[model samples]
Target: MRGRDEESGEFFSPSRSQNRRDALEVLALGEKLVALTEAQLAKLPIPDSLLPHIRDCRRITAHIAHKRQLAYLAKQMRREDDDVLDAIRDALDEDGEAARREVAAMHRVEAWRERLLADGDAALAQLLDEYPTADRQHLRALVRGAVDERNKNKPPRQFRELYRELRELIVGGSAGTDEEDADNVED
Candidate 1:
């Protein structure tokens, strides 16, 4: 179907090389889909129709059979709408990446909370050095309450609250630094 336009002398479709490149990109996307576990695939926006093909691709362990299945998957993917393919790519790229980062940040916060509980004043001093804007008095109060709760075998309400406050301080501090680093890079 690729030919020159009668009136404008422009191509009616992509050139052969461009067509091949597009196919390869789709093939690569198919590979990504094949490599993903079922749980990861569930997070994607891929259509149900493509799922069986992907599963087949995953199930084939033999070299030639796997290769043939991969090609079939690419062919099926190419038949899908351009918008659907693009949506799948976008979803793959942004697959709870922000949420994952936040979770990692929360883990760091948890570590700091544990350190504060274990190391007491030394950890608080180190934390203050990192987050100069942190409310020292408020943090000390929360730490004391958390310690008292642990001693009395009471509910860890203050322990949870301390974690929340630590997250706000540490994650917010890191975010500001990240923006500053980006600004510096722009210069």
Candidate 2:
């Protein structure tokens, strides 16, 4: 008295296949967004108004994906015990708060970077004047690496270290030595 067919050796669930297709579509959409962003950034006289919108879209996408992952994990929790569901809910709440804090910090960093870019040569010249010993190439590398990590959805450990090193080099006016006195800081 077996229900499944033996010769075909196939499962007959339609919903499962649909779910996989939906996941593939979402992945494709993400790829398209990345490509679009790159193309939009390359245009001359870049539309200043669009930058904030682009950044906002990226943030919203990140937050939505995070929430979706949490929801999926919660849904997969064993239903035998109510306590497991409650724990998952609590954990998700905590994660949401942490994510909000991270987003706020990221926005601050983005604003500072935008300001630096807007200030143009004067800002760069001031940095050079303030930190004569620091290498501009190193500063650029650190900034680029930090941005790349942010774009790749990776942890910020190395990026943070690079940023700190760049900051130290700028503030201390020394490239090799990591010593920085607190008194000279203007920021």
Top candidate, metric TM-score: 1
Q: After superposition, how far is residue 181 of candidate 1 from its true place, in Å?
A: 22
Candidate 1 structure quality by residue, lDDT tens digits, 99-150: 5666667667787888789889988997788778999999999999999999
- Each candidate structure's TM-score, on Cα atoms with residue i matched to residue i, is 0.55, 0.27
> Residue 5 lDDT in model 1?
86
Which ten-residue region of model 1 has the weakest summed lDDT?
A: 178-187
TM-score for candidate 1: 0.55
Please list the C-alpha lDDT of all candidates, in the order they appear: 0.86, 0.47
Per-residue CA lDDT of model 2 for 38-98, tens digit only, reads 5544532223443443344455556677455433332333222445333323333436544
